[model samples]
Target chain A: MQIQTKAVNGVLTLSLDEKRLDSKLAVGFKDKVGELIASGNRLIVFNLSAVDFIDSSGIGCLVTCLKLMGPKGKITIWGLKPPVESMFKLTRMDRVFTLCSTEEQALQAVNS
Target chain B: MNQVSLTIDSRPENVPLVGACAKEIAGQSFSIDKLSEIEQALVETVNNCIEHAYCGSEDRQITIKYALSKDRLFVEITDQGKGLDPQCLKKLTAELDYNPSDIDCLPEGGFGLNVINSCMDEVNYRREDGKNHWSLTKFVVPLT
Candidate 1:
């Protein structure tokens, strides 16, 4: 999985540059986020605009990241395509994670 | 009707390959939405087989057979590993009957079977001759 990261107003925005976030890339995705968290980056936004497919393992990776970040660390996600959005809703993960429609909204969510 | 079969190692890396194959086969007749649903169900079923049936054993093999008719698409996923436990299947079916809205009580895992059940039109499981077989069907009208 290719992830592009940028820091804006102390918020780390990691954009997924892949079409699918399935089991194949779940472990690597988790590791990359782990590295970012280790570097003291707490407020994170995942831009998933390009990803159209995600499976259970992919969802598990995100949950794992959220748990690792703990309560103080904030993680927001935006740019979820409809199918991917539906998966989050089906598993009720949409409730657990902060979801936004655009990057700006996600930034505001993390900032708030 | 047309049919295609795929055999892959029981590994996470092989999932995308099999998924692509399924998409290509199903895409021949169904709309993108239907294809997406089938792919989602297919991934969940294959993932379950890899995780539970094979238990990460790379040596094990998974065979996926796709049969496409005018009105429906049929998929059979088979693994020659430990078959599914009947009690667990019953429990999962029960869990899928209710959708919990509470995030605090939301389950992290054990949602794959539910996803499959929700996406596919019909789902059945059987174990015979030391092989676990999962049959999934999706009814669709071919795109004009």
Candidate 2:
């Protein structure tokens, strides 16, 4: 559950530096991201560039983060690998969450 | 046909280890995306067994077997725990329900089996002799 955090244009961008966002680290991942959200970061760009896999639990974890962020808060997930993208598609999360293909798009999404 | 079998305690951390094994075994049989899908499906299955079947009881054992033929790969998981309810399995087989608009209405879990069902070409579940069994199959295009 290692995350590299950077701030751009007053938006927080957290890059996940892991290979899989599965059951093993789902809870910790959620809590860490939630903590950032709680600490007054309303707009977030989650970089998943290095992540190759996401299970249902991991998907659920992201959903929980969205809820934790509330209505005014937005979290954009970008840099989805092919498999990561497919999980979003299969679960139809692509419709609910803001999924971006690049860091610029992610930053733009959260900023908007 | 070639087959491999291994066992692990019903721990959440162990699921990915098994998943990685499946990916390695899949090798050139599937594309990188397909391999990732298979690994996700396998991880979902084992997570279900660890949570629903074993009730998060880390002391229990889960056995996973991988068998590969010329055209398909099969994964079977066995656990000495409670079997899934028929109603639940039916829902997972038939439904992919979720709220696409309201974040408040979204579900936090219960989509594991649905992912498995969607990723793999075939999925089956049964209970025999007090053990729960889950069988998953994926059609592969082996590389030359």
Listing candidates in order, what is each one's chain A TM-score? 0.96, 0.95
Q: How well is candidate 2 docked (DockQ)?
A: 0.82
| Candidate 1, position B137, lDDT | 94
TM-score of each: 0.91, 0.94
Best by DockQ: 2
Model 2, span A9-92: residue lDDT tens: 779889899988888888899889889888988788889999987888889999998899888878889899888888889888
Docking quality (DockQ) for each candidate: 0.47, 0.82
Docking class of 1: acceptable
Candidate 2 at B98: error in angstroms?
Answer: 2.9
| Fnat per candidate | 0.41, 0.90
Residue-wise lDDT of candidate 2 within B34-96, one digit each (tens)? 887788788888899989998889999999999988899899999999978988887567677
For residues A14-112, write the lDDT of model 1, one tens digit per residue. Answer: 999999998789889999999998888889999999998999888888877766776677788999988898898877777678889998899999999
- Judged by whole-model lDDT over C-alpha atoms, candidate 2 comes out at 0.87
Candidate that scores best on TM-score = 2
